[model samples]
Target: MAIHRWRFVGIFILLAILGGAAMVMWNFIGLLLVSFAMAYIIYPLAGYFSGGNRKAGRKYLTACLSSVLLVALPVIYIMIYSLNVILQWLIENFGMIQSGSFTEGLKSGLDSAGFGVVSERLGSELGRLISSATDALWTQVTQPTWFLETSISLALFFVATFYFLYEGPRLMELIKKHIPTREKFLHELMSTIDKIFYGLFIGHLLTSVIIAGLAAVGFWAILRPPLITLGFLVGMMFVVSFLPLIGPWLMYVPMGLWYMALLPGGTMPGILILIYGSLMLTIVPDFYIRPKLVRRDADIHPLLILLGFFGGPFVMGFKGIIIGPLVLGLAQAIVMLYIEKRHILEDLFKRL
Candidate 1:
């Protein structure tokens, strides 16, 4: 009895410590989850690179390389490219604003519309608003605290990814050993989770690639942007498509409008791109290809999977993309497992 009391006391102390840790590290939870998901998705690549070698050094090397190649490099490139593009656009627009051309044009348009008296006031207010926004943006960018936090988060993410990739198999075995559940039930749960991950990561990634490739071709044929610039833009669109309610249309539509408005004889190409993007980039891949690929691996309904993709982000911001589907998929798995073992459950209930 004394030993049992000590055991209970130990468990209570452990729980308290864990709860405190969770509260303290709450901000990092999303980054860790993302790291785990990335590690899971790229584990196969690490395995492939290992080539049957079970040596610890080989495992570490393969895991590190896989994390860098499959996750880190792409993310770094995207961040740098996006920042450069944004800076260039801001510089050009700032020049225009400083020259008074943009405000003058707006004021002239307002005057022609018979609002001459209000034009000056509106232009002045707009300029002030723009200046305030620019200042705010600069201030945010230059904040040392923000930069430090972001750098730490990114560093933790990469380190976590590498650790998970190297330790995944052992971690799974440890979980299996510790979980006090029937082996069959545990196996089924793991299987269900695996299928969900496959459906979310592999299906979505393939669909994005196909759509982005088509977009790149369409952009080249229609807009005639430089090849390198076209690739970067299309690549950015591919990443952006993962966000809820924003997809390739975020790029193509704006480009189409710019082409129609700014360039002579550009109307037909712009119209063609809008039509092409609607059919090829957005409609077909989203409705048909994505669903088909997801359903191939995940036994859950495609509509539910789609809901997870869109709804996860809505509920949990960016991380919802993985977490939302995972939660719903786990629920589905539990229901199916219960159905499969209803008789056993019924007999147990009767005994109780």
Candidate 2:
């Protein structure tokens, strides 16, 4: 019995060591996945180049060319340009504007809407509060540190994308080799991941394009910044919405406020309306559009989304929510299947 216990302990230690090794080695695999994601995103464009070539037999060279020149080059350029834009915007307008105090603004607007001398006093107090908030914001930011960080992150992404594009097939084969073929649970898990990610990948791109088009139209109809560039930036943010929860809100709230402020207002009421409208428009896509598109792959509730978004980062870091849920879901599916197959429902639900 002692000898058997020792053997089990030895096996557990070996598995732990292997897990540590895999964690350390994950960078290479991560790069491969990132490249696949990049290539998948631009596959349509690559298809344009390879579509004719497919008519005869098969031409992978067309795909390679399109991926390298069309997908890779453009994406790398955009990443660099975006990094620069972010750095520049930070440097230039570190605090050229602020929202001031919402409480104060509300008080003043209410007073103007009519409440006599009491309202005027409240508005005056609110003005001071807003002034205090805005006054604290005006300052010069040292941007070199920001530029350095941006430079490093983009450089890594570029390097990863480069190698990924360079060695795509071997990675796919490696993935296929590891995936369980015969198990019903494993097969279903694989199916869910492939279906969900593919839909999410395409649906997100379409959503971003649609949102950007709306933003551009709204901007052109009324605002300053150049259309093409602003549209691209906003569209990029919309794409980032794939991350869930805070990502969409972060992108929209500031822009919505900015648009409202820019609207020929001091009219206050109109600005309030605009702010409310923009917020509604921005928030609607997640509830309405995402439900239909993402429902197929992941039947995750919004509460689960919040937990995943927060808990994932705490446990596993930036991309954790994506990786964590995929893993947990697979395990859950496997366990559930086993329970059903063995007619172990009473045991399973009781445990739950």
Candidate 3:
């Protein structure tokens, strides 16, 4: 027992040292991981298609892929279209509130509210800010095509995903050849990642989509930006929304700022006040509901899940959110493995 415990500590120390030494080789490690994550995601899809066999499986495989392609292609097209429309809208209205009359009116309103001195300070700040912002905005407006081209990452992501699905089994077997099988480490690793990727992580992603859809409709009905575009933007924030304060707040702050900025000049001040006041009341309920919905369904501790999420970025680089839970899952699996090993060893010793 003592020797085993010391061996565990020694192995942990050795791993830490090796990991630190490998930091310079991070890019190569990153590519390898991306391939693994992609293959891991795809293997099940292929298995589902192949029916775990070489016969009578290609037809099911084709049918599955056809269905996926049918839905995915149109959705991607619409997202691109909506993104273009919203970018155009912002370009058209970017400078609406930067004129002198608007500033003077805003100052007068602040004066009436007993914030005249504060308003002057804000006016100076606004002047400096808008000057920089306007230049940036003009550059962005003139390059809408460049903006669209940036979505190529999304294209890469889905394409990689598709290839992973098709070629996963061959890839995994190849990987197993390079890794040891004495501990079934590859199987254990996959088992851990499968739960994190397909279980809790997928649940959060789906929930983010639902929340964004609901929010866009709610905001459009009330605040009324380019409805489809705003919904899609907010929906996409699910990518970052789990991070707290920074995530959801990033989307909402813009929603409010734009609500006022885009309104009629005569009413801009009134709208700004209303927007801020309503957000102060509504934002709490908005963020509070999402976690409750997700955690309740997953039956996982919120703190546990949150810690896993924060720890993900540090450990797994970009894939940490998916990888974080896998790390935790593997830790649990390792503990179980050790316990089983201890039991078998004890039984063998007694028989001897």
Candidate 4:
């Protein structure tokens, strides 16, 4: 009896120590989670590469290639293209971006909106904010410490991601082995999570890709910003997919405003882009296309997904967005499992 009690105490102590360590490393936890999430997102590619044969060496090689294809290659292209666009924009419009014309235009818009007082306040606030930000940026440019820290963090992020991708399946299996519950229940929950993850991530990715292509074509005819930059912004709409109904508009409307308010002879094209984008890209794709894609992959309600998307970011910052939907999915799976085990639905139907 004493030996059993001591063993229990030892286990408890170990858990306490681990929990403390986890708390201490909470900041890095986000990086770890991001790596794991990336691994999960690209697991299908890894599987395809393995061709149903699970050799450790092959799995690692496949994981590396998958990461390169999905992440590294795209990022490199985006960076190169985006930097060129940015440099060109600065060369052409450095005077505009840094001048009072921008502020005067914004103030005029605010006055037209019957918010002259707000405009005055906004101007003052923006002046102060820009002053402080410029000073901070100058300091950072003159200093090397922050740059080094950022570089180290970025390196760690990639290293962690590489390992997570390579060992993700093994890690998941190990996690399942230790789940303190009936294997069936655990399996069901995991399966549900898998479905939800794929539904949200892949649905967002596909929709964003389509929207980016459309936006690139649309912007080619209007919106003076580089096609790549505009398309990149459109693609990044997936970041705000939690607020689905309004998110795309948040991007497109601003883009339209940039053209209308900034460039001469841009208002008509800007208005057209706004109307067309809101209708075709934002509404049709979000409400109709996205629902079909997500629902096909995961047996979840659209409203529930919206709630998870919105609520997650509110509660847990960015991580909450992913975690919120996952938690909701897990809860749903548990409820379904309980209903199945107890025949709750059948009982309710009979009673009715």
For model 2, residues 1-352, the per-residue Cα lDDT tens digits are: 9999999999999999999999876754544444556665555555566663423223645565556665447656876676567556544543432443445555666556555468767766766664564444332124447657645655666556544543444565677778756444445545555554555445554454455555555544544465345745566565455444545556545555644454345344435435543554465555665555554544433344445545765776766545554444445545655665544444445555
Off by over 4 Å in 4: 1-5, 50-54, 76-105, 108-143, 172-183, 209-217, 226-236, 239-242, 247-264, 271-318, 336-352
lDDT score, candidate 3? 0.55
Identify the candidate with maximal lDDT.
1
lDDT of 1 by residue, 1-352 (tens): 9999999999999999999998987767678877877776677677777875534686667655765577688787876776667557566676676677877877776666556599889877887777676666667776879767767888888898888777777777787788656445556667667786676566665567678878888888877885547867887878666544567889778767756765578889878888888888899888987777666646555566668777988988987776776688678767876798666556556656
What tens-digit string does per-residue lDDT give for candidate 3 at 1-352?
9999999999999999998879855644444455445444345455565566523356645734653465458768877787667567656645664555545656676566555479877766665676566667667657968666556645554565555555555565677677755445445555544555544544454455555555555555555556545655665555545543345556655545654554345245445534643453245335664444443323333454577677888876766765675566456545554575666445546656
On the 0 to 100 scale, the lDDT of residue 307 in model 3 is 70
TM-scores of the candidates are 0.68, 0.53, 0.50, 0.67
Clashing pairs in 2: none
lDDT scores for all predictions? 0.73, 0.54, 0.55, 0.66
Q: Write down the worst ten-residue block by lDDT for model 3.
A: 293-302
* Total backbone clashes of candidate 3, pairs 3 or more residues apart or in separate chains: 0
Model 4 Cα lDDT, one tens digit per residue, 1-352: 9999999999999999999998987878666766666665666667667675444696657656675467766765775676567556545644554665655666677666555578877865665565465455556645868657656766676678777767767777888888755345556667767776666566764566566666666666665665545755665664544344455677778767866887677799879789878887788877887776666646555566678767987987877766776677667766766776555444445655
Q: Residue 22 of model 4: what lDDT?
A: 86
Tell me the deviation in Å of residue 270 in model 3: 18
The per-residue C-alpha lDDT of model 4 at residue 90 equals: 46
Q: Model 3 clash pairs?
A: none
